[model samples]
Target chain A: MSRLSGTGLTLAYDKRVIAEQLSVEIPDGSFTVIIGPNACGKSTLLRALSRLLKPAAGTVLLDGGDVHSLPTRTVARTLGLLPQSSTAPDGITVAELVARGRYPHQGLLRRWSERDEQVVTESMAATGVGDLADRNVDELSGGQRQRVWIAMALAQQTPLLLLDEPTTYLDIAHQIEVLDLCAELHERQGRTLVAVLHDLNHAARYATHLIAMRDGKVARSGPPGEVLTAALVEEVFGLPCRVIDDPETGTPLVVPAARRKTSVQAEV
Target chain B: MSKVMVIRPRAVVIGAGALLAMTAVAVLTLGTGDFPIAPADVVKTLAGQGNAAQTFIINELRLPRVVTAILVGMALAAGGAVFQSITRNPLGSPDILGITSGAGAAALAVVILGGSSTALSLAAITGGIGTALLIQLIGGRRGLQGYRFILIGVGMTAILNGIMGWLLTKGVQMENARALLWLAGSFDGRGWEEALPLLGVLIVTIPILAVVCGPGLRMLEMGDDVAAGLGVPVKRLRNGALLVASLVVACAAAAAGPVNFVALIAPNIARRVTRAPGPNLLPSMAIGALLTVAADWLAMHSGYPLPVGVVTGGLGGAYLVWLLISERKAGRI
Candidate 1:
């Protein structure tokens, strides 16, 4: 059974509606990736599920309780989110930045316990940022900085974690590095992970369950083997593509169809 | 159980040092005026061991001005740190948020109307708070997000400055001089009447801000989405901090008539001294008290007895120019 789910959600910014009555479920202990073309509302759906954006209509359920109805700190203890863009304060060290994730577990009188210190250390180690704890976050490479951010989310120690395009703006190798870390957290730590990704192949490779969106609605959602196909990719992304198994992992790989060479040859 | 609170040694050292320096300056100021009490005698007077005449001079004549200067400095500095953190810009002090301009305009109006000092103080506070509410209503639709709030505040400051100029023109010569003296910001002749109210507000608000809100506000420096994701009620915290900070600024204005640059420069100086990230609220307060007390001492000792505001304004203008150049060199402007 799913622990986090949304029903009949109508998302919008101001007067402009982005989705209407959209429903989704994130399977417990599964690596679920939501993929869609630009402006397809995947990130908005993630925001609503994380309770960063309140839905105009309907409810987001966490463990059968309405998420919006719960105390924000209570919800935060159970769920952590890594937003698409967040700036580290000027001159903040990696450890200091990661320690901020303890906010939900902290209070006015009960700040920075032994457990908090242990968790921050473990989170940094788990993300391979332990050695860089003293380094200024502003001076880190993009890949290292992304790892530090993930460490911060890990420090929250929540069972469920949401990432909004966590791989954007990174190079291909860094993207793979970040995805591998997410996969490791899902596999080794048993975190129920939800990520909105732009790369179809990466989603297919890393995601145990996939949700493909078109316009403002879910086009298909299932295991990648069943949901990712040439026709589905064409329909959802409006791209003519061929789907083949990834040689390394046997997951679906989308290769866009090459354009005809007649017009190019004539121009040349 | 051993509570493992994060503590920076450097900040602690800086805070302690600033407190010591501030006390030294305050004591020296108390001893240096026309009566010329020695520092030892000033300490004795503070300890209630001085003769009646010295006691009267210290308690009745000089102590109130020093206390008011310290309180106003602490208030403005704390307010400045809050604004800078919220806006994530060094220039985002209470002055930039139009608090000083609003208070100045209202006080000018009172001076022109030949109001009593008590009425003038009340008017200044009311005007500052009213401007804050208006700015929040207009620019806070999307929460107190960064550049938009600063831009709106700049616009409000411009409008209020125009009003202040027109009011000055409408006043007679004597009234204009009175208004200008108040505008220049001073602690001359101020007594417990001003210091007590400011102290009361600071006593209630500063602890709450430092203990309850400081960590949450630090989280906000990461951005709204991140802070919210971390379970901070971002809008509520921002609004609450803004209101509390505005009230502090208004009260300081009432006490000292819109002292310039203490709010603008204190937080930055505190940050540099401690070399710590986040708002550095406590350090800012200490540094602010030191800066004001020191400046007031210099003004009192400068032979001609210039207003404290003139000294700060002149020094702050130079500091601002240096700040712009340094920020530009760092490519942060």
Candidate 2:
């Protein structure tokens, strides 16, 4: 297990500036949800923090050491990422697909040990895709397939997991199921997670801490109730919203007021 | 011997078995040439018990062609498997990048210029690797899209083919009938001189690819973005794979005069047989070796003698069609 902290991250894509002079301390062992409308740099922030994108200025420090300076396999051993829409080799079984995650751990002479097997088996079991271990990954339904992919990321056995839109392709039921699995993994493994989620309510319910982004800047960030207010949602999402409390989780719930017809706005 | 012969698949097991049977045919071919040795005498000669005449004929005449076919076959199949997986295009081969045409054209130049046989082989190998490198350069750094790579390769093939056709028109060059057949891609008249170089090259090259390309091949399969994210140097891996594939093609083409179709078929056959998604190298090499030997044997011993290339090209073309039809039938296309 490992913990990551420290930042002074200024990230940009080529010449198009995104985040500038950004710094934040991510506390260890917490579920952090980054939520914003598309193109607000939420995903870009995650990419920078995970060392997938180099900061134009500043550094991302993992456990008091520079993340980029660390050996790739060592960083991989500590942190795992499930990028949005990863393509697996077609026709590969779920078990074989999961087996690939052990690549960083296994070297030429030290390949495929019992520990690798146990990790993959336990991951498939923990992610609730144990039965799908033998099934062709491509043949399973969207939600089942997503879990299989999570099992692959889990098999890395990293203490920190980052997911970019894990619920992108799933239906409502499947989205909840996928997030529920993420929540379950967080609870069982005591791993810190940072995910870029599209659904605000889901983010509020699942995230212990929430960061809202607007136009490549952190608009607000704190406990979900404080950050996801009606005024903040309207300002960040350009949507008028009413806030309510969830009966199940006691998280702030956002209800969109209504689609504003341009003609009605003109009348107003 | 362990009784537990792990059954991989019927097609793979039987396919390899058929290839071994083809090796016998190649040996039989050796003994049947002029100054022929009888089958029993060949066995005796191999065992160091035959008469002098039997020993000379068996040792001198037959072994080279058989060995040549086996080595070239293994090389082509290995090349095919790597090419297909790295490109993630099942239809891909190093030949698709026009390395074969470059080798053939170089060989053609040497033969027409009356260069020694060794010079022709050397030229073919040099030409093949050079052409493969050129293509990789064009597709290097910021990688070329799959369709763009294929387009460039097709253009390269067309240019090399034109060069070959143009060179032949330069003089009143009267080619021997055997030479003409060889140009069409044959293993007919080849002997030990040809097989030896191919075998030496394969012994060095195949194991290198197996070891070095093992990790890089997986990186290639994961697509460049993810592979790079995983700390693989993408362009470097790409270059390494393409280089190995080109060398394999060059050695095979130089030895066997560009035996057609096996590089295109072996990997697919191996993949289908194993039911594994990524390219299965060992199986591909086995299938490639089997296909070439079987095609060569069938060509020599069929209803009448034909160049091995003609048989391979014809069979390979039909296999392509059958594959297309089957995929279409299964709605996989």
Best by TM-score: 1
lDDT of 2 by residue, B1-333 (tens): 211112235546756665776656665666676576666667678888988777776776566676788788888888888877877766567676788889988888887777888888898899899998887778654464366676788788899989988877753446534345656677765788888777787788777677666765665575654454444556666788778788888889988888887888988888776776666777788788878877877886677878788888899889878986986797755
How much lDDT does candidate 1 score?
0.91
Interface RMSD of predicted model 1: 2.8
lDDT of each: 0.91, 0.77
**For each of the candidates, what fraction of the native contacts does it recover?**
0.70, 0.20
Q: After superposition, how far is residue B202 of candidate 2 from its true place, in Å?
A: 2.4
Candidate 1 Cα errors over 4 Å, as ranges: A262-268, B1-5
Could you give the CAPRI-style class of model 2?
acceptable
Off by over 4 Å in 2: A1-26, A48-60, A63-69, A261-268, B1-19, B31-44, B110-115, B140-146, B171-182, B219-234, B302-305, B325-333
Residue pairs with backbone overlap in model 2: none
Candidate 1 per-residue lDDT, tens place, B175-278, comes to 99988989989999899999999999999989878887789899999988899889998888888887888888889999998889899999999888787788
TM-score of chain B of each: 0.95, 0.86
Give one digit per residue, the lDDT tens place, for model 1 in A1-268: 4899999999999988999999999999999999999999999999999998889998999999999889989988999999987989987889999999999999978977788989999999999999998888999999999999999999999999999999999999999999999999999999999999999999999999999998889999999999999999999988999999899999999999998689779799
